[model samples]
Each structure stands twice: as structure tokens, then as C-alpha cells.
Target: MRENTRIDWHARVEQALARVFASLDEPLAWQTLAGELHASPWHFHRCFRQLTGETVKQCLRRLRLERAAFQAAHGEARITDIALEAGFETLEAFLKAFRRAHGISPGGVRKLGAWAGTIAAPSNLHYAPGEPRKHFFIADKGDAHMDVKITTLSPLKLVCYRNFGEYWNLPGTWQKLFELMASQGVAMPAPTGMTVFHDHFDEVPMPDKRSDAAVYVPQDIELVEGLFRYETPGGLYAVKPHFGSCEEIGTTWDKWREEWLPTSGWQLDKTRPSLEWYQGHFDFAPPELHVTLLCDAVCRA
Candidate 1:
């Protein structure tokens, strides 16, 4: 195969994997996926393991368990139904796997309404042809200077563009959103734009990070393709202004989670997502950027 074609295979496999996640109700067969990729089953399996660092069986099992765990915690579905949906033929078999992975029963998780162990959904793995792979962001050692304040915010309704993948790749999503907004005659110098994070990227794998590039808009704006309204929950939040490049903001979040929250006598409100408020037009290429990181907090201690 040509080098470019070989590289393209990685993307093709990633899309196929995403399809598997999206259609968990459908039958999952290696032969079916291999035929779709136009490769023999043995070659497809080898390529998948090389690109994703996990075997096909391992990935499917993890994805199923993670989905089941999420449904148990958030949905009003029966445990047996969830088990069957996750491809388990029997509730006993599902329970055994769930307990082994999470150290708690599905019923126990539902009762607590929270995950008891590290159960994360599989992320889409992308491999560049020749570029060196970059590791996930990590904070520099030491206390980052942060202007932390406690503030209350009213609910905000926004028109948002959603993206799933690495946090660092979010600028592309924003770029697409800007083009859509410009086409609609929306001005560039609007108030600060916001990005709401549904998952903590540092804790979650890169493939699983979910974020929204959003701007506050009136309730009556006409919705277009790829743009939907998101209503943010209003409550008390610990806000901190971060000044630097988008690449460095992860360090700021690490500081807040590790250095500040522990001493502030406040606990994180797990139900709501954290927000990133961008001041002015965010130039993704520039080394300096200004954003405010918002964390939902309550004085529970």
C-alpha cells in the first residue's frame, strides 16, 4: 500500500470504531467490520491493535461496560435491560464483569447515583502518518498564580457547536462555528465566547473528551445545521482567570483541582460541567490567550 493510503486507513478505522460505539444495539462482528474496511479479518485486527493500543475484543468489552455504567448511573432503565443492551446474554454474566471492573454492583452504583471506580468510555484513537505523537497535557510543578473568586451566575442559553476528541483540537471546532456564525451575519466582536467542558480531559482519555464551542445568544435566534441551543445551569461557581496560550490552560485547571479546591473548604458539584469563558476573539495560533475557568462548587465541608 502507498504510505498515504496506509495513513488513511487509520482514519477509516477510527470512523468504523465510532460507528460501533454509536450503534451498540446492532450486532458487532469482526467479519462485518473487516469487510467494510476491505481487509482480511487478521490484518484488520492487527492494524486496530497497532493504532489503538487495545485488541478489538478488549475495546468492545470496555465500551459496553462503560455504556452500561453510564446508563445505570443516569438513566431510569432496568439493570437487566441495560445488561442485554450491552451485549450480555445473561444478567449474571454482566454483573460478574461489572463487579470485577468497578468493584461494585450495578445496583450499588444506581443507588449511589455515581461511579464507584474508574469507568471511562473508549476514546477514538487517531494516528498521524509520520508526526511524532504528542502526550496529553500536564501541569508544571509549582503553584500557578490564579485570581480565584466565588460568583453566582444566572442560567445562560447559547448557540453551540459540539466536538468530540482531544481538547487541543477544539480550535478547529471553533473555526467551523465562526464560519457558520459569519455566514449568518453575526459580528466577530461579540461578547466573550464560552466553551463548556462536559468531561475533564486530563482525567479522561483524549478520545473521550467532550466540549462545546458556544456563544451566548438570545432565546429566539433561528437554529441552523450544526448549531443547537444549550441551556447552562446557573449556580455558585469558583471562577479563575487564566492568561496564556490555549496549550497552557490545562496547567491552570490542574492547579485549581489540586492546589486550590482542597484548601478552599469547597467541594466540586459533580452534576454540572465546568466552563471556559474566552475574552475577546480567541486567536488559536497566538501564544497568549485570556480565558476564565469556571468550576461548580459548594461549601459542603
Candidate 2:
């Protein structure tokens, strides 16, 4: 069962969150925390972000603000004291940031009562005087929604442009890649567009997530600036053909992991990358419907 792995992840994150809550005023001890969790810094960062849907920095800041709000609304502490405790060095800086975060000055939180300390967070985590959450973030929402096919793949020679940032902004990158292709006079034997995710979707924040927009090209294809030619080693993959808006593709992949992988008699090959093949018109408009084959590398379970 996947229970052991999931339990271990939850336990590790619970420990880290507790440590973070203990020192809201200080920067999180990333290396030490990673050590305690028995994970590399990169892996821990990704795991935390994936579990909370917010980076550690973002989580710490929001949690501290929640505490400040609680103090303002219910406690008799002075506003300056609350602000300082919340990690702001000065009252003015605190007020500006506080207003920006909660849509009002610290003073306004006093009128909110029960709602005062709550803020919109992806994980629904808040600052409360209680034990940490066992289930930090929503997982396993994916069902048998995508039609997944298990198959073997051949090697691929690709010329790709890597981009980093919000995946939602990938259409813009696709457009830029096309322009680069035209400017370099790249010919059209490029039948399909490929995207290779160097990091897991949850491994890094959207800004740091590395995605390569690639097209199949010759092994000896001449490379230009911002474009590199490389061979993608292929193997067993679980693929799903997603039709419609590119924005909805994430759900497909999520279900592929949550619903399919556990039951499929295969496991993800972490050494390889998550890959995708788009076999349709390159409208460069993410909102426009398109067909995509989402491929995840796998090995025998």
C-alpha cells in the first residue's frame, strides 16, 4: 500500500511545521529542518510547497500575520507589540504590510472577531494554538477521470527552450519559442511540441519550476542561443491523451498520480523527467482547446 510513504511525508511535514510555528520571528532553518526530515534541501522545499500549496516563506509570513490578527482582535496587547511579535521591525512597515495582507490596518482586525485571524490560503492552514495538522493539504481529489494508457517509448532527439515561472504563463513561453524558431529559420519537420518538466510540479514554486518547450529535431540539429539539442531517454510511460483547454491538463496529471499510479503495477522513475507531447495546432493560446499526450516515466513496481 501507499500508506507508508504518505504517512512518512505527513509526519515529516508535521514536524517541520511545528518548528516553523515555534520561531515565527526568525527565518526558517532550512538546512537543519531538511536534515531532520532526512531529505535534501531541494526535496524538502518541494515537499513543503506541495503539501501546503505555499512556499515556506509564504507560509511563515501568513501564519505570523494570523497571529497578529488574533492579538488585535482578542488580546489586550498593544498594536506595536503585536506588530513586533509578528516579525515586522517597525510599526509603519507592519501596518503597510498588514493592510496589504488583510485588507485593513491592524486596528481594523479588532472589529472582525472570529474571522479576524483567518486569511485565504491554498492549504486552508491557519495560526491556531493547537497541534499541527495531520492532513496539511488536499490530495487524492483525482479520480478515474483521465483515460490512461501504459506503453513503452522510444528515444527522442529534441531541441528545447527551458522556461521558469507559473505554468499558467506557459502559453506565452510557447509563443516566444515559436518566434525563436522562426527567427532562426528552423524548418517544419517539427511534427509535435514536447514539454519536459525537469522538476516535479510540486518540487519548486511555479517561478522556479523548470519546463522545457521542445520539438523533435535531428540529432545533429544546429543549436542557437536559448535552444539546446539533447536526447530524451525513453522507457515505460503511463500516458493520457488530454483534449481541451491546456489549463485543465493539470487535473489529468494529478489523477494520473493519485488514482492511476497506485493501482497500475508501476512506479514513477524519478531519475527521468515528466514529459508531454502536444499533437495539434500551436495556437499559443492556452485557453484554446488542444490535444496533449501527458507522459510520465515509470519502472516496474
Candidate 3:
């Protein structure tokens, strides 16, 4: 089952790569790619990220930069044209991304032909002119099963408010979300509070890291600007109960990703943001008594 699932995703990803290569010069949305590939946007993004260890955005940016490097090496086009054809909205953005990724500017590449093709990649994938190459990973599935559970999550209509800055420093955000809900006279089905991480913590810039504090409400509840509605798609998720000091939550997550996930018969579903689902009023609960259900999106192997 694991092999078959990976094979299916491998083929689908190759199709996506071909599409991306053909349209390098065009502005493409990750969602659009999912549509063209006949997949749900979330599922497609998740599969691509899991398989390549790169977000769809990251892969696109890398490919554009690689293409730019190729053009510069040939000395066949101006940097402006190269940037535009690479689908970068601005040359400054292109230059910044290129310099950061390759440790050299396009000009530098053209001058010395030092296109760093060895940009670190788990799948070892890079730019190819016509169609990209096939890439997949094979790992032995270990038999160690921890006390984690696989469960189905129903679709959710969430009223969320965005919070930026340090992810862990969000007591005020949750406070605001609940207060706004009260001001709007919204009554939730339960007193559940959820925090959804919109970006990977380590990969995203600290200043731009984003999360949403949300509460589940029925569809009939009206939404205000302070609280917006987001629908979480129904799917399989791996649920692990967390107890004790919230400060140590990071350690638990590390163990899951580094120790359990790689060997589990499930792969991360990238389409959904990781969630911390809280049951009791955390603001009032003692640190030792606080309980959180750490939910990670998952697909069967």
C-alpha cells in the first residue's frame, strides 16, 4: 500500500513538473496547478511538499531562479527579460531570491557561469528546460507504533483572526478572537479554541510567520471583519494528546516529525495547516493541567 501510494503521487508530481516547466514564463497559482491536475488544492500542495520537502511556492521560486541562471549563463537575454520570463513580479524580488538561493546574483552568474546547481534539495530536483525529471523517495517503514491515533475530521467552518510575530506568544490573539466573538453575539457549538499554523516555523521568516486563532461556529453565524470564515476540509488526521507544560510542545512535534512520521504508514498532508486544538479554557487552566490535541494532516500510505 505504501509503495502504491507513493507511486501514484510520483506520477502525479511528474505531471505537475511538466506543466510547470512548460509555463515557466506565466504567472501560475498553486491552486491552479491542483485544478489542472484534477486534485483538491490542499491535497495537491500536501503531496508535493511531502514528496519534495519543498513547498509549492519554494519549488516555483527555485525553478524560476534556475531558469534565470540558465539564461544568464547563455548571455542570451537581458536581466529584466529574464526576471519577467521567470514569472517574478519584480526584478528586485528576483535578484533577492536568486542571490539568497545561489549565493550569487544573475549578473555574477553571467560573468562567471557559476550557476549553483547544487541548491540543497531532499528530492535532488532542479531545473530542466522542457520537462523536469522524475523524483521519489524510498524508506523502510518501521514497526514501532507510538500512542497516536488516526481519526477523521469533519469539514469545519471556522471564524478566524490572523496573528503574526512569535507563534507561541499568542495569548492576546486568542483573547481578542473570543472578545470579538462575544461582541458579535456569536455562540459557538463548543468552547474549543484552535490555532492553525499557516507557515512552517523554521522555513518562514520570523517576522512573516502567521497563524490564525479560530473557533468553530455554525454556518448561520454572521462574520465580521475582525473574524473571517475559513472552511477546513474534511480529511484524515493523526491526533496525539498533549499534556503538561505548553512550553515543551515543540519537543513533542520534533519527535513526531523526526522519529515517527518517517516510519509511519502515513505521509503528511500539506494542504491543511497544523493545528493545536484546545478543549478547556487555557487562559484559566494551570500549565500542568492544560491539554491540547496536536493534530497533523495525514494521508494513508
TM-scores for candidates 1 onward, in order? 0.48, 0.49, 0.48
Ranking by lDDT: 2, 3, 1
The candidate that wins on TM-score is 2
Ranking by TM-score: 2, 1, 3
lDDT per residue, candidate 1, 1-301, as tens digits? 4668757766767666766655566777766788888889988877666556466667677767766877787789999999998889999999999876554678876865633223321232222223433321222222334468889878888889999975645667887888888777786535757888887645677678789998886536566799988888978888877754453456457656788778777887767778888766654433233445555444465
| Worst ten in a row by lDDT for model 2 | 134-143
Q: List the residue pairs that clash in candidate 3.
A: 46-270
Give per-residue CA lDDT, model 3, range 123-234, as digits (tens): 5456755553645342223225456798998877788988987654465687688778877787542476688877744667877988898887764666767778887776
Stretches of candidate 1 exceeding 4 Å from the true structure:
1-146, 201-205, 282-293, 296-299
lDDT of 2 by residue, 1-301 (tens): 1678767777788888878877787767677789987899998887777666667788888889878887898888999998888888899999998876665566765754444345655455667765544345543223444468888888888888877865544555666777777777776436777888877656666668788888875435456688877678888888887654453466457756887789778888878888878876645533223578889888889
lDDT of each: 0.67, 0.72, 0.72
Q: What residue pairs clash in candidate 1, if any at all?
A: none
* Model 2 residue 226 lDDT score: 85
> For candidate 3, which ten residues in a row score worst on lDDT?
134-143
Question: In model 1, where is the ten-residue run with the lowest total lDDT?
Answer: 120-129
Show pairs that collide, candidate 2: none
